[model samples]
Target: MSNHEGTKGNLLAFLPLIVFVVLFIGSGMLTNDFSTMPLNVAILIASAIALLMNRKETFSKKVDVFTKSAGHPNIILMAVIFILAGAFAGVAKGMGAVESTVNLGLSLLPANLLMVGLFVIGCFISISMGTSMGTIVALAPIGVGIAGQTEIPVALAMATIVGGAMFGDNLSMISDTTIAAVRTQHTKMKDKFKVNFLIVLPAALITLVILGVLTRGNAVELAGDYPYDWVKILPYLGVLVAALAGTHVLVVLVGGTIFAGVIGLLDGSYQMSSLLQATAEGIMTMEDLAIVSILIGGIIGIIQYNGGIDYLLRMITRNIKSKKGAEFGIAGLVSAADIATANNTIAIIITGPLAKSIADEYGVDPRKSASLLDTFAGCWQGILPYGAQLLAAAGLAAISPVSIMLYSFYPVLMGICCVIAILIGYPKFKRTDDASASISK
Candidate 1:
């Protein structure tokens, strides 16, 4: 069979991916707990399956393919970023940066704007912290309290928080989802952010308008004090500024961690000893994710070596006759993976290579492909009832995930805007030698 045609002989090449989905999702379905099956373990099992598939190749040769892919520079760099991001988040939260940031945003907004305030704050905190679960945990109780104090539905308040968290998860330079998308697509963070921000900005604004209408006439005399220290928030702001200025991601993360640690020490939030422990704890938190990325890389490497990627690409791009179709295909591919895994970052890591191949083959912009991968994955991950974001928010609010899903407007709108972006070819970029070339100029 010709390489372009991706003949039936390659069909079995997809079995490992299918097995992974079944092991992960199927176990979740049977146990009623997605967490029961760790992602890395599932990927490991699938990697084994992939290794055993191409029997014609010697076992040592197959191991080389797997190890080579796992050890690829991009994969290693992504793992390092994960480590740095974990440290920065841990240090910032340990030093009361999160509390102060949340308090500041809450204190500045009036009672009637509580819902909108939560949304905006969720966006800021998630973008800085780079985790939707963390943002939801930080804000869900407050959202429930707002719902109780006002006429707005509890589900609606929670939805706003989820939506805003997703908004940031898609655009944040520090977000794992964004990191995975950018690295996998070989696009710069700022370039992906520029593309992603334009697509999701309209969704955010429309969500604000919707929340405003819901919050109208729901004003309450807020009864609690929200104390904040301005100095503590500078780490988040500084990191954000540095990222926007296009500083190297490593420098941005390391600077943010150091800045947060210094602030914490100065404020007596923690001593040097405590800061060190916090950083260690933060890095520990990312161990699972780093391992998962490496395993997925190996699994993909083996799959690609066996022609699975070619088969999948052929199946996806078969009907595509234009760049728009290819963009939609990329979006659909990542969205499906997100749905299967219920994890956006993992979905990006899994689909990124194939998406890049599609982009290269179809002339779709890498920035746009990265944006679609993140945005669409965020879209699915945000609304999935079994997904961490809704489950965390629901558990915090003592409500069902479906309740929040009913009002989760931002993700739905984000998906719609992604479709519209493709249809209209919005946020056009130049095709040049440099993938990160300045598109604005």
Candidate 2:
């Protein structure tokens, strides 16, 4: 009864966010271009609504709440990562690393297996880099080029890259999602990774097979000089090695950018001015996303302060009677958070603490709860046509993010696999720490 009563005001607190999503989606539908809606603008207006709704607090105090949330440490870290990712992508392209790397991959795969190879490479690169955006930035352009060369739908190629990126985002030990999930649930990264990998491996294998079969009828062939420059790829290779060796992503990206810039300069592939310009351009490209991220953070913080999320927690878990219900609740919370923020890492961070509480109450394995949060969040990230993975991939490929939805089977399959994991409790493990509900595979 208390939960039922708590939900009443809480539902109203979240209305502003609902309005924002409606306006954004409505404007897109009116324009027939989903990407036409300025997400930051919608957020700003909704933030204003959130302020108006917070009548209990003084306006000044509400503004303070908004400001603190917007500038939170997690948001700041994400902003920094965005800037470096953009710079690395731009400078590497300026240095011919993209072309060289794509050619290298093409050189290794037959025409019919191009999509399969690209998806596999995306998996490896994302796992190594511990970032889906970084992998997408590095690989989507190549996927686009492959589509152009082979007369395939550009959407299919980009979907392959985006799908594989999500895979690693959920499973990579060094990924921010992994770190956030593990820390929040008080589980080890290896434990989460092991459980996560086992749950999602079949989804990946099926995706590979689907891509291979789809591309098998390709009558078109890869074109161009197919130039090979091992030197240009060294920066990417070095970054991969550093990431897999457990180096921080920011350090790996910054070092990789400088390495690519130097190689470009030494090899006469880029002028000093051109390299700087490329870096600047790359940073500029990420401005929209960066700003949107901050606004979402502020809006979410305000909502939470006003009792929106707590309301959700009570409402969603009011009837959770078993471990399965708890798992779904955990997954649902993060998925909702991801949909609201359009960022999986932020989603996990926002829901993780509450998820931990729920896990403890229901005796759900921490490893499984962490995996559920990561997997569900990762799934939504892929399917959200306006989310970072799709938007970034679309921007790089020069295509519509919506088109990729038709071909993005991997994330959908991944989501299904996670649901199956919840139902069957596959890859079962014994709990190690009775206190924290630690699990051993």
Whose lDDT is greatest here? 2
Give the TM-score comparing model 1 with the true structure, all chains together.
Answer: 0.64
RMSD of 2: 3.8
Segments in model 2 whose C-alpha atoms lie over 4 Å from true places: 1-9, 186-188, 222-225, 360-363, 398-400, 428-441
Q: How far out, in Å, is residue 278 in model 1?
A: 1.5
Top TM-score prediction, candidate number: 2
lDDT of 2 by residue, 346-398 (tens): 88987899999999999888888999999999999999875778867766665
The clash tally of candidate 1 reads: 0
| TM-score of every candidate | 0.64, 0.86
Taking the tens digit of each residue's C-alpha lDDT, what string does model 1 give over 192-230?
888888888999999998888878787766678878788
> Which pairs clash in the backbone of model 1?
none
